[model samples]
Target: MVERVDEQDRVLAVVGRDEAVRRGWLHRIAVTVCRDREGRILVQRRSEHLARFPGHYEVASGGAVAVGESYEEAASRELAEELGVQAPVRFVVKFLNRNGLSPHWLAVHEAVLPGDPNPDPDKMMWHGWLSESELLRSMEENLFTPDSRDTLSHYFAAAERPSGQP
Candidate 1:
């Protein structure tokens, strides 16, 4: 079940994921921007079998926020599920993504994996770690997931902000 929400992200009710998709109901999603200790970002080609954004490259591992789950909890679960790693993640930003397949409030987080990720084949067909510059360059040549691209942009913007500013 997914928690349906209003434009302001206040939960309205719990509904089936499919129903939410069918009706274009707003919901919560948690995204994680993962990086290795060497500062290379992890990128993956999503499995072609997935219904949404199949075969697109993504810089993050994430999914819908399950009913009763916090954004941090969802982010942690998704990172482990898609990348096979358990690590602490920090909250980054939250914003409404109206341009995606469906509208949702996205909570973005950041994690530094302890070691190489063993990506699940069911989620991604290929995975690699790339420098920030390389990832930016590759984005121009790859069909990357739109939400991940937005997450990356917001993440970079947050990093560039002054510490005292929101």
Candidate 2:
């Protein structure tokens, strides 16, 4: 079962992923950004069989949270399921997705990959390690999913900000 969440991302109910999305419910999503030893980000090409944003590139590995699962729990599960690697996850931020296609709450997390990722064939077509500039170029060229595009921009912009500022 999937989690149906409130505006604050508090659990409101439980339902199937398809049904939750069909009803435009506010759900919790866990987005994980994995960096390589050289600090390049791992990006994935989504499989065509996926429900949303099929065949698009994603800079993060993630999915909706299940019922009774916390953001951290989902992040760990998704990281392993999609990339087959595990590392300590640092919580980043959360926001509401108001796009007509995916109305939900998104939680961002960061981790370091131990090595190259072994992507699930059913979840992704391939994976690549890209520098921040390359990732931004790809996004500007519209090669990434809407969610990934927004999340990457937000994450990178925040990472570049001065520490003392809010």
Candidate 3:
């Protein structure tokens, strides 16, 4: 089940994924940018059978926060489900995607999962590790989901900033 929320992120109701996406309802998603010990980023080619952005590239491994799950919990769950590994995830930031397409509240996180990720082929067609620069270059190529692109930008900017600053 999916949790549908309002502008303030308060749970308004519970619904199925199809209806939520079909109606563009506000929902919560936990996104994780898993970097290896060598600082390479994990990227994936989404399965062509998915409802949205099928066969496209994704900058991170993540998914919707279930009807009753925290952002961090969803992050860990998604990483394991999609990548088959567990790592301590740190919350980065939360932002709303209020666009016409696939609107959802994105909870961004980053982690250093220091091992090979075993991606589930049914969910992802391929997976690889790319340098941070290569991941940034991916934005220019328009190869990622809109939310992925936005979250990556936010994550990068946040990473470069010094502490005590917004």
Count clashing residue pairs in model 2: 0
lDDT of 2 by residue, 76-149 (tens): 99999988887888777777877536698887899988889888899899789999888878777756787886
Clashing pairs in 1: none
Give the distance in Å from residue 114's predicted Cα in candidate 1 to where it truly belongs.
0.7
Clash numbers, per candidate? 0, 0, 0
Q: What is candidate 3's lDDT per residue for 1-166, written digit by digit as tens?
A: 9999999999999999778888999999898998999989888898999877888898888888997899999999998998899899999888887642678898999989879888998989988899988877876775787677788878988888898677
- Of candidates 2 and 1, the better by lDDT: 1
Poorly placed runs, candidate 1 (over 4 Å): none
Residue 87 in model 3: lDDT:
92
RMSD vs true structure, all candidates: 1.0, 1.9, 1.7
TM-score for each prediction?
0.96, 0.90, 0.91
Query: Which candidate tops lDDT?
Result: 1
Q: Which residue pairs does candidate 2 place in steric collision?
A: none
lDDT of 1 by residue, 61-106 (tens): 8999999999999999999898899999999889889756788998
For TM-score, the strongest prediction is: 1
Q: Looking at model 3, which ten-residue stretch has the lowest summed lDDT?
A: 93-102
Q: How far off is model 2, as Cα RMSD? A: 1.9
Q: For candidate 1, what's the RMSD?
A: 1.0
